[model samples]
Target: MHDPIFSKSFTRTQRHRFGAIFLCFIIALAISKPPLHLLSPIGDAVKTQLSINNVGNMLLVDDGGRANIKPIADVNPAEYLQLPSDDAQNKRTSTTISAYSDNGIKMEKKHAIICKNSNYCKIEGDVRIDAKSSTILVATSFANMTKSWCVIEPYPRRGTSRVKKWRVATLEKNDISLPICTQHHTHPSLLFSMGGFTGNYFHDFADILFPLHLTSSQIQKKVQFLATDYKQWWINKFDKILNKLTKHNILDIDRETSQVHCYNELQIGLKFHKELLTLNSSPSMHTFKVLLREAYSLKRERVIRDINVPMPRLMIIDRKRTRVLTNEHQVLRIARKLGFEVVEGVATDLSRFAEAVNSCDVLVGVHGAGLTNMVFLPDNAVVIQVIPFGGVDGFARLDFGNPAKGMNLRYLEYKIRENESSLSRKYSRDHPILRKPELYRNWDQVWSIYLNQQNVSVDLRRFKGILVEALTLLYYK
Candidate 1:
């Protein structure tokens, strides 16, 4: 015998009770920091939020400069984040640091670093940060012809709650420190450094999706893009904002410094060389950069210090845990026969994906968030993406704004058997694969069981069109 008002009244009362408890819990947390010794992944999220806030303050305020507000975003934009086999928290790694290259510190595939403490480190070094947990990050340097990285560790650590001063000095005339990298350097030209002066502070600001400022000229040269209506909304938003900031002075892309694929905190458009600031392990962003730098036959290459130890090839990277596509192996086999290098790797992280793509001439994948790795590829690299009849077409059209310059789009239609009536009308249908469904209804629909029972063959004609399209683009130079 529940009264209408009484039943709802109980619900309301319980809600209020929980709210009070939650409010009190927040107050308790506000009063004191949690015991960090009880470190767990659950605390990782909280620590990250605080870190983002800390980085944001470093960029916006007159704290006159700090670590180029590391761009650890609020969201993990990875397309696939496979859960661990067990529910237990992973504790194998001690820390996560940003690693950069200088004279004394050396890189091996982006992570698994080696450092030699010497006075020579002053000429070409980067910054190191204590990002909570016993972890230290070795991030890349944000400066001219220099690279940096940060390492994260939880063992045999240095630094305390009050001070994080370590082996490197970030603010001396000898070594270009992280904070000084930002404050001291304002004229980042295409020749001296890379980004921060490439695009308009307003329009180019909108192109990159993060809050970074860029000047006009760099936007014109480094920002290689073909415009479309979809980009119009972003362009409009920036134009309005610029009108206010300029007082009609910084009129358009003509005046503002441009944004490029470089890493900066106040203005995060994109960064191709962020490894110089991030601490990644071998087979990582740092590794790729180290190899590319060596390709130029720099002093780092002539004197093969550490990374030259036969790092993993692109194909083995395909089998790494990051790649978890359903038909990955199958597609690789087919692509190999079709005269394409079949690398089976995933661009799970955006920055890492950018690094991976820079190493390849062609990128192919099923049309999914996983394939946005297109953003990472070199200009004019061909992308052949499979479009499942159910979902892919609409998304591919939007992902590529211009069919001419940045991306070469190719679509492969998925195979789907039509309605049962079409098969029934086939004259003398000897093929068991397409046998009349009415008579075949006796078979269990379980796919694996029936496949073992019946020999099947389908026409390969349709796939040839896609292969030809891919080869044509490959030879395009």
Candidate 2:
């Protein structure tokens, strides 16, 4: 029954069948989008071809507005990879396809949700706000089996410790259960929470305002806001800045509990970079400073670029709570003696305080939230942050020092002696709380003992030198 010629014939026929199947598979991969490379041997070739077609010759403009037509080689293919969609037959795709300009340059494609698993999601598409349930519903055809819903904190910081208290769910659009939109708008809406250390001025900027600026500015400030964890006072406080940001109203979503608000597009959370410290990238710090000045109607751009300008104005932030400058009057006296026009920053009302801070040439404060007003200071101004005794130089630097440098302001840190700290009254010289604060178990001890209970009676003679340094920097410039 085993004939050699017949056996050879069967083997050839089987080989032909396998070859046809493999060709069909390759052809299918060539037609399909996304993961096509994963299935094909010529993946790299396909990706390179796509890149050449999409991003090779792009016109890029530098800061001086010089447009250079350059071909960017070694571009990452992943960013240019076609976004996947579940419904291939649907005419209106879930995610907006990337459009090219008239010159064939690729534009930023609109996305439904760019998610990093269940933990963090940045949604920007046909988003609906169901205020009653505190749920954000996005209409997308890409809802998949893995995750159909996401829970987000809506704040910039997504760390578990920062966001554990607040939770908002982003759901896939469902027609049957979802409420009909009472209010519909064309502009993209920005959804965020005013929770988690909002009252503190430092957090007010770092956590909320700066991040909001980055997000809104990216879209050219053409957005509406839907705010949860509503605080009217907070709104009133920054009304100028908020009003400048959007032409539309900022709706308190929590207050609008019975209604569903919808937008043509929505960015469900604020964008932040580098721990919300520096505006290292485009929409730079200069842009933000311009926005601030325009918002507050501030005139000053710098601390008098001419060296002939006399007696640069100084602002001493007088803290009423913890970390009070016990010898602030003495400090003021010395500042006046140094040919400075001293004004006290009590910070009773922020909008007014912002104006005053802008008018000044130098800001002096104990290491606290009041120093956050340095954002309002003009360029080439100086900031003197008197660090309280407890070896919190790193914390002080992170919170204010680094940020000040990024804002184009001169910075000086005056580390107080143990005798200058109010802690000396409570703890002995040899006590671990004073001698070795590193031994403290956790943040609780760091906060309750060092940040909360501490006050600085800064040595007048030592502090004067720092203030003099600030004066010299401002006056000479």
Candidate 3:
């Protein structure tokens, strides 16, 4: 009764001391050993703090107080993160190797497969590139042969097998023959050849980038590229498209022939169906056109047919040497008379040229590699292929006509008459090179005369009708 204040202060001090001792005990208990029964509660508390929810089956409580938990056999760990209702997510589940630890948590392992067909060879999963030997090493327990190897030329065209070849081998775990990995990449690798007909504008897209887009679009830009027969100019030329295709830097396998680069997943070679066309595929020509527009940051998706302007912009692909438009000025005059703003698609940097091509509503060109720029044209645009006079409609149609429809463009064939061809001026009408040119079925024969040495002077009256038709297609259909 004499010192009530002193008694209250003493009680507060004892409570503070007891709180500190309890906190220390909790910390020491966590450091020493975790009890199986307490693990779920501890994990739940942490999850709650992190605002994590619906992580089903990842945290199993040991209700029986047993130290061991049964492993989830052959079940992919990524599946647990998604809800059962997410079907699309399940289908796009990333390739992963799954294992189980003593605590029943999923661990990762090496899994690989080398799938080969007549068209291409696709190697995926835990892969290593030994540049010293120009070989690709895959790690997997599924290698039944103890050691197995196959040589693959990772290009789309089989005609370029001599350009480059890569040795792919499947090695068992703990194989002493494995090369030391100098670098590790978190993302998957896409390996292909830049050798086969890459310099040509047609082959650049038809053979390499088109097939590459078909193959890599499924990965959602999570892959890096490894190119054999690599060219810096080619890389720079398609930098914009490459940027849309991948976020990682491109590695030149030929130049860096000393490092051993390893990746969790690697895909050797691209998937190619046919040249310049995608048939019954997931990424159809329309989808590819959308990708191209997005990659170039093109402003137009369709040809502008505004009531205020009422005139469409036209692009004439002017070739310098072969298949030159001899009377280009008259063609320009006719196009202008019909209310078309004309511009020439000439040789320039690719990025700049792509923009110029996309801005136009109609693309006019002779059947040549320059017409390949139609890949950059807007949807519903018109492509007028002026076929040189050589009885080569089938060849010209195969090259540009059929693919134009696939890209959602209106294709028009303007077959130049004999009088319009420079070959007509050089030779007589009854000459076999002109009159009976159908006899030359071989491409080598056709290439030397009609393709290699030809120029066109369009019949003004007939060509004007083609332009009129192009205008009708733009506005009406």
lDDT on C-alpha atoms for all candidate structures: 0.28, 0.60, 0.66
- Cα lDDT of candidate 1 equals 0.28
**Cα lDDT of model 1 by residue, 1-477, tens digit:** 223543344444343344334433432332233222211110111112233234222211011122121111221211212212111111221122222233223234222222211100111223222212212223432222122222211111111121121232122224533222222222221110112111111112212321111221223223222111122323343343333222222212111223211111111012211101112232232333333333332222111113333221122123211112334555555556765555546433323444555555555543223343443444445555443221123323433322213223233333323221123233345655345333332212211112112211222354446555655554533
Per-residue lDDT, model 1, residue 164, is: 20
* Candidate 3 positional error at 254, Å: 2.0
Q: Can you list the residue pairs that collide in candidate 3?
A: none
* lDDT, candidate 1, at 381: 51
lDDT of 2 by residue, 355-398 (tens): 89999988888776667778889999998888877646666776
Candidate 3 structure quality by residue, lDDT tens digits, 149-195: 55566765443423487776667557778877888888877888886
Better candidate number, 2 or 3, judged by lDDT: 3
TM-score, one value per model? 0.28, 0.71, 0.74
Best by TM-score: 3
Query: Which is the better candidate, 2 or 3, if ranked by TM-score?
Result: 3
Quickly count the clashes in candidate 1.
72
Model 2 clash number:
0
